[model samples]
Target chain A: MDLHAMDRYIKSLIKEAGHKIRNSFLSDISIESKSDANDLVTNIDKEIEQFFISRINRDFPGHRIFGEEGFGDRIEDQNGVIWLLDPIDGTMNFVHQKRNFAISLGIYEDGVGKLGYIYDVVNDDLYHGVQGGGAYYNDERLRPLGITTIEESILAMNATWAVPNRHFDHNGTLKLIQDVRGIRSYGSAALELAYLASGRIDAYISMRLSPWDIAGGMVIAREVGAIATNFRGEPGNLLEQDTFLVANPSIHSRILKDYIRQK
Target chain B: MDLHAMDRYIKSLIKEAGHKIRNSFLSDISIESKSDANDLVTNIDKEIEQFFISRINRDFPGHRIFGEEGFGDRIEDQNGVIWLLDPIDGTMNFVHQKRNFAISLGIYEDGVGKLGYIYDVVNDDLYHGVQGGGAYYNDERLRPLGITTIEESILAMNATWAVPNRHFDHNGTLKLIQDVRGIRSYGSAALELAYLASGRIDAYISMRLSPWDIAGGMVIAREVGAIATNFRGEPGNLLEQDTFLVANPSIHSRILKDYIRQK
Candidate 1:
């Protein structure tokens, strides 16, 4: 398979989908909650997912697509030539703020990530990576991650993790919050990972996230030498929702061992 | 005093300052530490503060200026006409991320805020307000804030507040984090208040902020019917650094009374 041609084709398709999503902001947004009030799904989210599925099926008939919004084909495993898509990551931000949202896509061949793309719709920033070819933030090749300790690092962890909850032990998470230089939460897992890859922030932690939410980011982040793993310091499960910790390699092990207590 | 004229003048000055700051990113940044390694001050910050002080002094004589970089006039009191300037509110973000920073300025006459402006440099979003006249994001007038309960609101509080700290009691802050719908930390107090005024977020709480950081945001936020006060529920002091909480009126008192315990 021609990896260069596939990468070029995927980038164009993501941009096209992003433009359509941007145009939708001009009109009224039909919003509905899913699972909970905070979990929002808009009409545009479904439409964008459908758009990607149609394009992929028409252009590459042999590939399988797994997407959020339930508009694409369903698969139990990360099989050959699988396309994982999140039409709108940070849907709540999109529904309310009209910014800070992105279109995330990851293309894996034989269960190995070959290419990834995350497009910040409002900022027009496109962060992409071709495995072993290095990551690029809109044509500027991102440098590999540098070593940084937790005390000097700025982390992106949601504050909810610091409070007692069913997901994990809150005591360890609270201690981690005090140990880091600072904290940030953009409400988008994909964008947080993009930031980690770019070295804008040193680490990111989330208790629960699905494959579509992190697939694209995982690919881009790995190219820049950032580490991604579940709470147990094991490899991330690509086919299911799980706790995640992605960070600069130097501090990743320390955090997992000292500040993470599984509930 | 002609607030209308001053508002117009300050708007143009902020836009000019913002444009200059955006240009500075094209050149190399000379950075230095202030109180600690994390507290960064850049050459551009001093230059921009000097630029504002010069313009204000030249255009509006007899006015005093209090700025973050010490290039402005020495201000001891909130007496007489005064301009509180933070050339770059989030200097760390300015030197590191090149975004999420703002040009914050508030003009007060004899201790009363007459006009305020917070310009988001990268996004080109200018949040300004004329006391009694109204608040605005660019030319659009902002509507008065509606009521929101703590459970349904999104609060922008830094995660540091939730950990055991010297400033405030962590247990209460941790509970607040759990009760709220979500929390966000943008790393810029000026932009956080701007977001609160725009209704993008519901509340903002900062344990330690200087007069320059909160002055512009206080004026803009108050115009949109949000309450601005110290953590103790008293009005924010314009002469010194203090803890601050700005929010939609409904939840402001509840958060202040129940959650914030100054240690």
Candidate 2:
């Protein structure tokens, strides 16, 4: 398979999708709640998703697509050359703030991630990685992550994690918040993971995240020596939404074993 | 007092300071811990503070300055015209991430805020407000904050607030976390308040923040019809560090009454 040619094609597609999404911001958008009021989905999201699906189908005839807006194929397995896409992650931020959202895509072959791209549409930051080749933030190649202990690290976690919730025990997460040097929550998982890869943040933990939310990030993060796992310290499920914790290599085990308790 | 001329002068001075601060990012920065390992102060921070102090002292003599770096006046009371300055509000972010910090300054007359500015240096966003004049995000005037219920509001708060801490009861903060639509922590109090003023986030809560940290934000927030108060619903202290809660007027009392309990 010509990986370099495919990567270049995907990057151009992502940039085009990003431009379309940004252009939509200039017009009025209709927003609706999915499961709950806080769970928002905008028309622009669907438009962008369909844009990617159309391009992928037209360009790559045999390739499969799994997209957040359900505009792609329904494949239960992560088969050959499957593309995972979240056209606009952080829809709430997009609808409300018109910022902090990204166009995220991950390409996999036989369930193995081959290439990934995440574009912060507003900030104009594009983070992409190839399997053997290194990751790049914009045009600069990202260096491997250095080791950082829990006490010296800053964590990116939602404030709701420490409160009473159905997902995990609050006590352990509470203790984790105290031990870390600082905590940040940018409301966008894709950007948060990109921040992890860029060393802007050391770790990120979220209770429930979909495949597209972390697909591109996981590939880029792995290139920078960061580890992505569920709270149980296992590899993330590529087919469904699940709990996620991505951290620097040195502190990943310590955080999962000591601070995360699955209820 | 020529308030308009002073406002214009301070605005220019802040932009100049922002340029200097941004330029320093290309060079090596010397960092030192303040109260603890996580509490950092950089040479650039001190230099920037001195820069503001010198500009204020030279440009507007007899105007008292209450600055974070101790290069300003040590006045016992907030009498006459006083400028409250936090040269670099998010010093940790500046030292580590090279972004997300702001230059915060609030000008007051006999303890009453007359003008305020929060310069997001990296983003080039300047949020400013004048007494009896409307607030602005860059050149555009900010709209007055509309009512938002707690269920629909996003709270900007530190994750540590929900865990056991020295200031407030964690249990109540935990419940508050669950009650809001979402939560965000930007690591810069001034920018957090600017976010509130710009309608990006609905509220901001911090356990202990100095006068300079929230001084500029308080003025801007008030101009947009938001309310700034302590956990007990009193006005925030202008002379010292104190607990702070600045929120949309609709939900400020509800959060203070239902979620915050001082221990």
Candidate 3:
């Protein structure tokens, strides 16, 4: 596949979808609850997801889409050229914050990530990566992840880690938090990944994320020499959802082996 | 006092300081260790603080200056017009993230906050508030915060809460985390406050923050009917360093009275 042509096409499509989202902002947003009361989905979310799905079906009929809104094919497996998309990664942030949310899309062929794209709609910052071409924020080439220890690294972990919860041993995560230089948690997983690719945050850890959540970020991060996998240091389950740790390659294994444990 | 004049002047000063920070990016940053091995102090931080101090003193010598760097006066009491300056509110973010940091400054007279400013130094976005006049983002005038409850509100919290650690009761904070619609932490107090003022995030909570940390944010937050206080639901100690919890007035008392407690 001509990766450059694919990248350009994806970027143009994401930009078009972003324009639709921006226009929807001026109109009234009728929000709805899904799965749970706290888990929300707005009309615009469904609209944008459908827009992308239809376009992809027309452009690349062979492409399989795994999207948040059930607008695409049922993707139970990571086979073929799968496009995992989160039209709006931080839905809460987008619905309320009106900024910081992003469009996240990752293309994986034969269960291996081939490319990733995360476009921060409002800022117009497009972070993209092809398997070997490396990541780019806009047109500038991104450098590989810098070497840094946990003591010197700034991490992006939500404050939820410091509090007790069910996913992981909250205590263990908090201990890791104190050990790091600092901590941050932006509501959007996609933008957080863009930041990690840009080396703004040395590492990112999140539990209970779907494949679409980390797909785009992981690809871009890998381009910058960052490593991403499940907590157990095994290959991330492309089909089953689970806890995740994406960090500087040097720190990934140690953090997984030393700190992370399943509850 | 001509608050309008003061506001204009301070805005210009902040923009100038922000410009200096922007230009610093073009050159090599000479960094040094401060309080700890990982803790950093950049020449740009010092230069910016010094620039604000010199400008304020030259025009208003009778006024006192309380800055992060020692360049500002040794402020004991808020007797006369005092400028509380944090040249870089999220210094760690500035040094490591190179983004998500801001220049925060708050002007108080006889212990009453008169004006507040938090400028996203990299993006050139400025949040400003005068006591009576409403808050603003760049040039857009802000409105008073609409009342919101815990369940409906989006919270900006450090991500460590889900894990266990010192400071607050991890479990209780978790309950607080679940009680909110969503949680976010940007790693910058000033930007968080600006978000609060802009009605992006409904509230903000931090374990331990100094005077300069929340001073500017408090002013802008106040203009939008957001309450600025400590965890005790009382007037926050302006002179003494303390933890910060600034939120919409409707919910500030509830969080302080029910959740946050002294260790």
Candidate 4:
């Protein structure tokens, strides 16, 4: 595969998708409830997903796709080349705030991530990484994350996870909140991970996230020395929804062992 | 007092201060801890405060200044025209993220909010309001908040407030977190309030915030029909630090009665 040519083509496609999203903000948005009232999907979300699927199929015939909007292929096994796409990551933010959402995409070969991209559509920030190459925030190269104690770190996660839930113990999550310097929730997992790679934040945690949500982020974060794992300190599942913790290598394990207690 | 003229003058001063803050990002920043390690103050913060103080003192000699850096007058009472200034709200974000911080300034006449301004320096978004005049986000007039129930609203607050704390019961806060559509924490009280005024967020809560921390936001929020009060449902203290709850008028009382339990 011509990785360089593919990277250039994918960047242009993501930018064009972003342009479509920006244009949608001017028109009326049709929204619907997904699993719950808070779990929302808009017309633009489905439209953007279809936009990517059509282009990818035309350019790469043999490659398969796994997408958030269910507009792509169903993979029974990790084989050949696969593109994971989340056309609109934070649909709630898109419907409520008209910002804080992004388009996330990742390319993997036989389950190995090779290229990743996350575009903040509203802010025009494109964070992308090539495996074995460095991560870049827009035109600037991202520096590898440095050591930082949990006491001095800023952690980002949804406030919902800290409430009483069956996924993990609320007490441990609350304790972690108190121990950290501060907490932030941007409502988008992909953008939070991009922030981690750019050193805007130290760590990001999510109780339940799908593969498309974290696949692109994992590739970018790993290039900058961030560790991605489930609560059990294992590589997160790339094919199933699971708990996710991506953080600077210095504090990842400490947070998992001392704070995250999964039920 | 001609509020119209004062509004115009204050707007210029805030823009100048914001310009200075953006310039500071290119230079070296010296950071120090205030009350604790997490409570940070940077040289740029002090510089910005002094910058505003010098201009206000020179232009409006009769007005008293209350600032976060203690570089202004020792305000004893709300008698004359007073300028409440935070110079740089979210100083930690300033030193760490290089964004999400703002210049918050509020002008009051005999304890009555007259004018307010919150400048998001990095984004160039200026939110302001005049007494009896509508609020604005940049050039667009902000619409008054419409009704929203607790279950369909988004709440913005620090996650630490949900942990065991002396100011309020953690259980009630946790319950509120579960009931809301979502929760957000942007690390800047002023920007968060600006967001509330613009309808980007439905409510904002803080356990301990000083007058400067919320003075500007209160003016803007109130102009948009949001209610501002302490946990006890009284007008928040304007001269001291206290718990704060600013929400859309529709759900403000319900939240206070059922979810906010002060201890």
What is the TM-score of chain A, computed separately for every candidate? 0.98, 0.98, 0.96, 0.98
Clashing pairs in 1: none
Expressed as tens digits, the lDDT of each residue in B59-170 for candidate 2 is 8898999999888999689889999999999998987688999999999899899999999999999999998898999979999998789998889999988868666678
Task: Compare the candidates by DockQ and give the number of the best one.
Answer: 2
User: Residue A99 lDDT in model 4?
Assistant: 93
lDDT of 4 by residue, A1-263 (tens): 78899989999999999999999988999999989989999999999999999999998999999999898999777899999999999888898899999999999999999999999999999999999988999968999998999999999988887788777798999999989999999899999999899888999999889999988989999999999999899896778899899999999999999998878
All candidates in order of lDDT, best leading: 4, 2, 1, 3
Question: Candidate 2's residue-wise lDDT over A58-176, tens digit each?
Answer: 99999999999898988699778889999998888887678998988898899888898889999899999888788899979999999789998989999888877776788999899
* lDDT, residue B44, model 2: 92
Top candidate when judged by TM-score against the true structure:
4
Q: What TM-score does candidate 3 reach?
A: 0.96
TM-score of chain A of 2: 0.98
Q: Pick the candidate with the highest lDDT.
A: 4
**The CA-based lDDT of model 1 is what?**
0.89
Residue B239 displacement in candidate 2 (angstroms)? 0.4
Worst 10 residues of 2 chain B by lDDT: B161-170
Candidate 2: regions farther than 4 A off: none
Q: What DockQ does each listed candidate score?
A: 0.73, 0.88, 0.66, 0.84
Kindly list the per-residue Cα lDDT of model 1 for residues A191-246, writing each as its tens digit: 99899889999899999999888888999999999999999888878788999999
Q: Write the per-residue lDDT of candidate 3 for residues B80-135, one digit (tens) a residue.
A: 78889889877788877788899999999998889999999878788888888888
A best-first ranking of the candidates according to their DockQ comes to 2, 4, 1, 3
Each model's lDDT comes to 0.89, 0.90, 0.85, 0.91
